[model samples]
Target: MTTSILTSFIIIISFIVKRIQADCQNNTLTETTFVYRRVCYFANWAAKRYDNISRLTPEDIDPFLCTHINFAFAKVLESLIIAPYEEDDLKGWTANSKGMYERILKLKETNPDLRVLLSVGGWTHASRGFNEVSKTAANIKNFVKNSVKFLRENKFDGLDLDWEYPGAKDQGAEPHSKTGYTKLVKKLSRVFKREAERTGQEKLLLTCATAAARHRIEAGYEVEEVCKYFDFVSVMTYDYHGSWDGKTGHNSPLYAMRNERKKFREWNINSSMLVWEELGCPKEKLNIGLSAYGRAFSLFGETGMSNGKPVTKKKSSIGIKASAAEAGKYTREAGVLAYYEICELLQNNPSNRVFWHQQMSVPYVSSKTLWIGFDNIRSVTLKMQFLKEHGYGGVIIWSLDLDDKTGTVCNEGPFPIFNAAKRELLILPDHLINKDKKCSDDNITITIEHLHSKMTKIKQSKNSK
Candidate 1:
């Protein structure tokens, strides 16, 4: 009897606490202040990485490190509805336990300012889902309804549509998909705005991962119109040049090599940004994509490779004959190496040369058999400065897992690349960037653990009764 009474008392107390918390949250989160966004993309599959240090779960994240976290990829179904791509993405990841969605949302407890968005579609999902969703007005309406419900039910702050290219024919995009794409975005924006007004909450943020190549952008987007609906456009500035070129090239050079052909010159960040501007997107609504990895090449005529690590003792600049480098040990992707792996190569080879491309404002590794182009702390700092100089909105890292996440490899510290970028990005004044931060988040700290504990106890009490 005493135990039952104690349980009842606990339940009442929890109920009261919840009501108070709700009131605080409802009144405290007013959209009136602003801060520059440091958007980090969380790759869900990183949990399966081969080793402890290489693997990352939500527990490994520093919630305060970024202003926004985009959970990389949920899928778009053939029925023109949204769905979780990974089986573990939905609730009950492992027999009634919280899944990736719950784990990531838990971050908000630590950082009330942090907004997490579910990113839908990726390269693998491609444009098919997008093309299908844009097939009709009713399809788009149903999609927006389902999408909004999903995001809200899951407590996501927004949705990031990552349609690779809306109108690229090679990607199997339906004709006039570009126009349809604009219509889709417009509808989402309108619905999100209306919902926010109805509920007295902030509107859900809408962003997109867009193509940086001039031709891609021109063909895929009705730039000025689309920009009006998106909170920001994350231009894919990396992968400007990779192994497919069959020659040495910078993956994301800040600028073109001096006096290059106009055709090739358009490949760099500087030119890409110019093209976006020419197409009518404002500089302030753009966030350039930052990569935490580099592209590597297998230089021709070099027998210097051992277990995927480059064995060459020489370095060459652009135009060196080469193909994609063997996949890095952990990343296991041909032509690509994580920042950590790049660091490992440098650390193992004391004689390896680091070339600072002054004009391109980036760095590359030189060796006889392989060449790698990636960003270091110095390079990242330069890129951040470039964002500020050009008045771009912010930076979006491709994935958090690719960085030296645990400080074991780089020895510079955990998340060295991220920290470097953060320091530079914070240089942007807060008041100038976002004005929706007026409410004090300090008063309300809602965490799933607390609620889950209460629920568990309530169940036990009922069973005892």
Candidate 2:
């Protein structure tokens, strides 16, 4: 009886092992010698999101999914230094408990190559502390000192500055703020270098997330100077259109529509990146920013046209006039929906149809009353191809948490966008990836859950033997 049971266990274990090995051997990631960067942003506020399943804590993050994860929107304090926006960012919330920041860093235990950064400022934080830091040499010095201390203390790998735009006087930016911003960037770069040499540690990566709009780029960035100083310039290529345009448009159109004119012609991913190159940002140092959320718009009563033809008698997203759609269930923002929220809407409503914009190279959902512009596996694959063909530095996601962490909502398995990314972009090296369960296919993602389960079972089988 013991021999029979042991044989059965070996057979079961062998089957599972064979499946993993087959999947791993077939992985395409190992074939490529070229290294690509995958920088993902983490939205800490998502911790407070209503739906527990949708809420993304550090625990939910797959460290192997990205080379660098920037914790979003650390505040610039009144003292001109950086600090966490959330209380959970620090430890001691409970007895001997780690905080969100440490929890995120601990992911490095699984992926030693993973870099965690503290991203200061966002659209909401705007230009608050940036201008202050740029005010004078003294202010800049104090800010840098504290920033280094905080980052080293917290064990972060680097910093990502997401100051909206530096020269937008309309947004309360001081005159000549671009120069000021440049000074700040240069200082951080210098200090970071010196600090690394002083401590005999790896140099902290210094990146800046900037505007996508051509005009904003020109106004807010002394591109040549800024690019020379920073490690990477992350140009956010989304939000090209929304309710702000008072009309329907794709959020991250790959190319400008033929119908677009004037400044609108330049509002596209390709056009913006071209502008980045034009402004002297080396393609190798340029990382295009993509979003995991779709900008939603409500139908404002019109059957828009396509190719000069009426877009059916029914409401459609083809350049239709629009207002704001209702807020997402978890994101709770009317003008946008998380990818998972969009998936929920698509799944719940069978009548809702998905349409592709060949010209824009993105997908959109058009229901009777709403339109949403978003990227999925198909489009993301195309974008990664574009990245490779253009020889750009890499791709950076707006927020990692927004992707569907649950397989049930999208029915595409968890983190489908990321899964597609792993296949299409760079593959994880063997050191970072589980050697026992190597994989590079979209369907054969070797997630943390997969590795942990296998490890547990293998240990149990050994005990059985």
Candidate 3:
């Protein structure tokens, strides 16, 4: 009970509080708060299907889960105007009479922070519309003007140009497509900026979904020049290899395999990100794309073998002799299956075997003659870790409909993959501190020291009495 002992106790408590505050400031012992974008694309076709198992309408979307939701496949017409690819997307005969566009905007009522952008020109629409529109300055001007007007009227936050490739031959692009692509983006950027200033509204975001492969990047993009005009770029990192190759391969490998073929070594997310970074794209302006679907193929060589095994050509196959497997129970695509469908296939069949590749950080399933490669929680976690370490801006889910809408597939809960990305990628406030657990011994020592000091004070007071 002496003044000196009391003073020492106060000093010790002050030191402990100061230490905790310092650790919090340094982001070592606690969560740190910061804003980051999580973009999810909602395909318009999802509303057309009426079946509960296969259909995923705008109402199924979790508005608060993403910072931006892109309404996909608003086509670019030959007349240089942006319009809905399907009439059903904009009009309905029901009593509600509200189409996909209106339904998506209604989500904002629940999550006011959400931003929706109209995504024009998907893989199918890009082949002709993009090439024609970007061919001349007049066409580009008309497209930009109509695009802004369309977005504003539809209650969209901005526009996302989903041109598959500008100079790629497969897409029917002309030789001048490279230069035309850059010119188009530049013009759109200028127009968007000017429109925002004149109307006294917030600057509308301008972004694009770009190719991830090295060859595609080289042939299609004036990478450095094109990236400067956009707010951000979503790199479509999935679909590296599929049934078209006549061989089984991972849909989206995180890293290139050690024994990969020379030609296929650069077909990976790592290589794509590196190529974009080397091309002068800022890390903060790049969002890596994730697929909620897997590429399915019928195996040729040894059935149930590990990935990267040699394959013999199957009869009646298309491009590369590998026959496309049957459509999934849900996705109903010949060579693809949604993540939920894949999970169901794995769970229902006890004979199906799963294999993981450490080098690529991906997983595959093989049973009898069917082989499928896909991303799961394990692979997604690794990708998120890489994104965090490499300073990437965020992630973009290709189409939210493909994920398990019902919580029955993965058993991890609704939107399992999306939830994993949000938890791993974002620097959320009030996250648990692992360092606090590590400091358990120190905490025990401090508690014991305080108890001893109290006992000493009590003994001293007794002696004085």
Candidate 4:
């Protein structure tokens, strides 16, 4: 009887605490004050194999929004909608149809300031769609006209084109894609800007997700002409070196360690910035890229890799899931590879060769199995600080879905990385106030007045309900 009574008391206390917290949240002026903080998460609905928009609840999208998070781009690459003469080319078409626009509109209604945009073209897919869509004046006109109608009908804030490349022509694609690409963007901008005026709608933002490798841009797209059509470009700076590169290095090196001196001399952030700036694009229009996840690699087996550890045993399998455990035996790992919230190497032993790179601001693990590289909170913070120093527009996350939804990674939620970037870069007026420092009573009075106004609004809402 005594235990039951204690339990009842605890439950009552919990209820009361919850009620107080809700009341405070409703009346807090900070919660009500609306400000447009510019940060965008690239959400790929069709590309994801498991996480689908239909399975997602309103809660799934809520954490991504607040006064600070003003924008989200639901990537609807048109290439996915088209058949690419491949078997899986039709794989995602059904799961990702035109209904994405409606789902995004629902998202916008939930949060007044939150806006959604559809992206077209992506790397490794639809290389030909760009050429097919832009090769002729008629095709360009149709794409632009239909896109304007689609945006208006669906109420999207803008559109982002993410064509991987135009000239390099990977796989079995066409050449002169760069030439046609420039004309296509020029044509689209002309129509989009004009339609906004005729309809009296607010300005529509035009942006692109571009390649980061120096050679890719110089060979593929005409950077100068492409910048003219876009308000800003998101440089995919990650994936610089991966298992595919056949070498061990950070996936996205901030300073290009392999060729740092040469990078400084010719191709680097400064040169990339110059390319866009010279094309008449404003500096503020450029946004860098960040990746929430990391890449893993496996090294050779039967090579006396078990240096001196027991867990350094080779895994009997491949893929990211087995990388950590399989790497346990070959204890001679060089870099740290982060998987979800667990690092197998770190858990087994901290003194292992695999460790964080302080200078490049990334993590990597070198093991007998293979050398792998990835990112962590420290690297993310460094990237954020870099953005602030450069005063570039903002940062773009490669994805929003892969983050651990349970909020376990880095002691923050899946989107914490992006949220940190906003706080450090945007400099909101509220955050500027030093909460620790004492302020005059006059400022306190003003804050109280605002809180009182919010209280009134809450009371009005309660009475209506």
Candidate 5:
């Protein structure tokens, strides 16, 4: 009798093990089947803004929401080595003086599959440091060694080079910046691959944050050569127009306006993606950038205009016009507002009206002189659909900090825009899988629950017998 009981227990244990293995295999297959990357950039400066509820710390991040989290703007030091952009906030101490790096690394406990990358350089960090370091083969070699060490020491899965523009003269890049940029990536890829082989680990991912504009792309990147070394290229598709343009326009429009002038037609997201594809960059390696903030401008004439209608700029207003509209309760920025802040303004204030452009698939809000163009859930859904249909790899958010982290503003839920994108992109199309077998988050959750209950029943039956 005891032997029979032991046999039954062993069988049960085997069954459980088989079930776990099968589930894991299914998950692995799912990931492999649908190759999409949802990359989120966490701005280190956010930790400094303690008073702002939108201020996000490393601990506030939801690891499961993204496939990869890039810690933004790690600086290139004078020694030509990579370092934390905000050392005190990123690797330094808390009020209790605990290391912040520890807190970020600990997030893997919540989602072991999540990849954390250290992103060096940004719009503000576009200094000559990268140029100087990439000048010579020896310099590139040393930089790569130090970079690999820095990433490994901090438990980072990879490195993301965020050089604003390699050959942009205004950005202080060197004359040989274009060639140097390509060489730097090539050397880094070689070294990273060799190191991975030596350490018996997966090859480290190497990616770059590239420009969206055609002029910037021509000035900086040798798309074919540079792309060969990168695991993926994140195209900054937003900021097509801002205070710099001295006019009201979409911060990130998915499609070109129906009546857009020829010169401005190339400014939209679709044009940029097509340009990159034509230049030999694979669609699978391109991740379109999405902004969580809007570009606000003050209009000179009409108070209300339909979406895509060219509004005249206030004469001589070179910078962002101060909004007569009430200050956002949180973001408080003069020229830009977070999606959360925008949602609050549109929802609570009935006078602030919204206009949707079907042609561009974007939205803008106007009240008096205040004009703001931004993306919300609907726009993001459309963009995601565009991405999936076009076979683009995925989407990358300019930041995780600017989104409605608490889910209080949009009322759609936390990371509402991002959630919409993920729901659309991550799910495999029905044609890709068995027609009758539907795969979705909801279906997966139900399956797991059913398995758990069945296991419980099996144990109960064993005891009764």
Candidate 6:
């Protein structure tokens, strides 16, 4: 009896090992099958011109964007954030006090199926607007009422609030208040959601952009409350390491490890997805962030160290810089630079590695005298796999404007990472899918409940239109 039990245990162990290998292999196949959803980031009329002047019009927008694209946001200002006397403070942008209704109407007419939303707040504009609007019931109601009118007049399908952060204090903003922000979001959700249903419009899409780091959430955002109000949230997961830190690394990495001895953690995709999930957000409503531009940095000099020390008389301390377009030369001089337009650097020596934190799945690179860490197609694909495995809502890029256009890699333009995702993941609508005998699992239902739930919402919104 004893001999038989031991033999059976050995067989079971072998079977488990085989199964683990098979699972890993299957995951590999899935990773290759990544398809990124599309989002176009247009902040205001100025951003809109970025596309038009680039000769990218409605017809051109279709190729790069999925049916659903986000019209970045409309900003509202409080006296505290922007001093009235400051020259060119948030200049050359549409104002909430202006007639955005007309602008929205124009957008609606252009792409009826396109989900037009009013994204509120941005990086530099994270004024105390969120805090003020979210603090009181009266303020929340007033904002919601005006927003609904804007939606109705402009024919926007929903509202996208681009609150750069709720708790993190901005340059012009006050400190964080965990409960105040949550209450505000909750009130907005209740009002907007209720109104949408009452009016028989497809459920209004409530969404926000959340910070990628876990600390941000803990510091200010009540993730659970925010998620409750939002249909989904985009994780601004890029910028893991850049000039901000004196190191170089990939902005976005798939399986990044901080230390050599630890297991790799896919921060850009898997970890970001898990961060929200662990925060009690439904995986279906979690979206990942991507960047079209790459970060660039240079190596200064070698010192006492021969191979890796400062040699030249150049400053021992590190300095950071980004490419600048000399006003009139965007397309010609930009050289398709990402964060910093260092086309000149790409001309000399284009590549270097910062270090990949195996435990975090992040990588950084340095060149010349600058260090940059950002995501590329390879890193994006890894993150997409995490999205598929975790069944997150979808993926989002920082701004569609930065997509690679020149045949940098094959015929695929700047949006290669996202394009690859669309082909593999089936984020493209069925109508858009090229019906061919190419796909092996063509007939399989991609719907796994939360998968493409946003698509369903979009369709319902379209039907309402």
Top-TM-score candidate index: 1
Cα lDDT tens digits, model 1, 90-157, are 76646878889999999999989899999998888888678878988988999999998999988899
Q: Which of the predicted structures, 2 or 4, would earn the higher TM-score when compared with the native?
A: 2
- Candidate 6 segments exceeding 4 Å error: 1-37, 45-59, 79-113, 170-176, 260-268, 302-336, 339-371, 405-411, 427-465
Residue-wise C-alpha lDDT for candidate 5, range 228-342, written one tens digit per residue: 9999999999999876665567789999876567888898889999999999999989999999888777665453333546444432222233333334556666678888888
Candidate 2 Cα misplacement greater than 4 A, ranges: 1-33, 302-316, 427-465
- Clashing residue pairs in candidate 1 are 32-435, 32-436, 33-435, 33-436, 33-437, 33-438, 34-434, 34-435, 314-367, 314-368
Best by lDDT: 1
Ranking by lDDT: 1, 2, 3, 5, 6, 4
Q: Whole-model lDDT, candidate 2?
A: 0.81
- For every model in order, what is the number of clashing pairs? 10, 1, 0, 22, 0, 51
Superposed model 1: Cα runs more than 4 Å off: 1-34, 302-316, 429-465
Whole-model lDDT values for every prediction: 0.85, 0.81, 0.81, 0.54, 0.80, 0.55
Query: What's the TM-score of each model vs. the native?
Result: 0.82, 0.81, 0.81, 0.65, 0.81, 0.65
Q: Report the lDDT tens digits of candidate 6 across residue range 1-465.
A: 444454566566556656655675676564533333445564343334443333322233443345456665566554212111122223324444234334433554665655655566777667556667665667666777766775665556666666666667543435645676677677768877788779887766677777886666777677776787787788887765454444334566654444422222444555766777887887777787877665454444322123454444222112233332222233343212442233333445645334444444444444444454555555666666676766776777766545543435324554565565555566543533443223333222232223345446655676786
C-alpha lDDT of residue 378 in model 5:
87
Instruction: Evaluate model 5: give its lDDT.
Output: 0.80
Residue range with the least summed lDDT across 10 consecutive positions in model 1: 436-445
TM-score of structure candidate 2: 0.81
What is the per-residue lDDT of model 2 for residues 172-221, given as tens digits with 9 covering 90 to 100? Answer: 77876788888888999999999999999999889988898887888988
> What are the per-model C-alpha RMSD values against the true structure?
16.6, 14.8, 8.5, 16.3, 10.8, 15.6
Tens digit of per-residue lDDT, candidate 3, span 1-465:
455676677678767856765665566535434555789999888766666766888888888889899989898878998888778677665866887788899999999888888898888775678878888999999888988898888878888988888888988888888899999999999999999999998778899999998888989898888899999999999999887776677789899988678888888999999999998899989999888888888755443233556444422111223457789876678999988888888898976677787788888877656777888888887888888778788889877888887777679788877877777876532432352332344675586578668867877887898
